[model samples]
Target: MSGNVLSIADRQPEDVQRRAVAAVSLQRWREIEHARVVKKGGVPVQTDQGSDLPASLDAWYRSQPVKPGRISPRLTLTDDEKRAYGLPKSARLIALRGLGDEVDHWSVAVFPVMGGYVVGVKAPAGGGGVGVFWRLSHKASDYARRLSVEHGMLIRERYA
Candidate 1:
């Protein structure tokens, strides 16, 4: 978990804010990142309400780091949900709640790679606040143990 809140840091002149990468589209990421910088300072990148940020916030948003494989964790996305929530076209289902047949809903977060914090955002009614955790699961695969241990991810029997 990040001990310091998302603060306005000195962005090097050479640092360019990325519009999109493999995980998200260029046009979409800009709009969402813009809202995030100005609104809740990093929580609720988008909300049930709405976001209409000023021009300067856009720059600040871009200054933040966004890399490949870092994306919103929702495997399914409806057309409307994509636009409404600023979701990417493709996403990974990173949880197995209950029987894991299907997920009802997903909370949004930035899942940083290795030692970085998982900063999450929930609804206002659901209690709005950032939740940060820094450690990775001991049984993790590439980055996270969202599904299960890497060696046993698919075939428990090892028959193949």
Candidate 2:
């Protein structure tokens, strides 16, 4: 005769098993929803929430060395700028220094907003900030180059 042994889950009450299943389903749904929100450029409504760069770009930026006494500070977008870009309150703007010309030390600020990516040059001593919005990250690099050229800044080799 074959032995019949009840597993721990099988020993649980039917109601408990149903509840466990429902909980797992709900968690999976939440994961899908969160991904959908991020893909749409909206912040996910979860406890772990903040704006960040795409992984590859972030890694590249982090790997670069900053010059002494030239650490770039994280710039805060003004209320008007946030509204214009359709960015949420939690959005973060990053400025990577030493990426621009050696003379002026203009940093490159990049961030993702509700509809697209924003690439800009931090204002030098007496100029206003220059920003360009693009639909794709790759396309934004072109705008970055254009901005550098227009501003007479030479971007560090291989950086956009």
Candidate 3:
């Protein structure tokens, strides 16, 4: 009998090609959403980089799409804002909290920068504002907790 073997490319049927195309489309959509969210100063729940963000921020990020225009701005830290906050260029988001009950209210976010962690707060009006740089994550977390308690807001973890 003659040996008949399907090549690797032949193994991929039209359904697989369709799936691949769909996957690419989904990825493009995600990328666009990620850019929009980041531009608006919001952290994306799922990133190609990885899920180093706290769970709360992840949840908030996931919910943004469901409520389109309600995504609060001024949640991400920019290069200039990082400099003002004394955060390193490698800093990444770890957690976040809203200062008020409304979705458009001011929010605070924590980033793990070199040497330690930094917690920055931003208002809806749009500004870098003030932030506290701590030598430890726990200390930064404690401060965030205190702020949450004081403002009667709920804080959520984005990293661990």
Q: Which candidate leads the pack in lDDT?
A: 2
Better of 2 and 3 by TM-score: 3
Residue lDDT tens for model 3, 1-160: 8998987756898899788889999999988977997888776544223234323432323333334565343345555444443346655653233322223455555556568766655344442334556787787888677656544555534442
76 Cα displacement, candidate 1 (Å)? 2.0
Better of 1 and 2 by TM-score: 2
Clash pairs for candidate 1: 1-134
In order, how many clashes per candidate? 1, 0, 8
Tens digits of lDDT, candidate 2, 10-90: 999999999999999999998997799798878665542224432222332444555678654335555434544444455
Candidate 2 Cα deviation (angstroms), residue 6: 2.6
Write candidate 1's Cα lDDT for 1-86 as tens digits.
Answer: 65855434334232332422323576578777778767856554445432333122112233335467963232343443445433
User: What's the lDDT for all of these models?
Assistant: 0.34, 0.55, 0.54
- Report model 1's TM-score to 2 decimal places: 0.19
Cα TM-score per model = 0.19, 0.27, 0.32
The 10-residue segment with the lowest total lDDT in model 1: 151-160
Provide the RMSD of all predictions against the true structure, rounded to 1 decimal. 19.5, 16.3, 17.6
Best by TM-score: 3
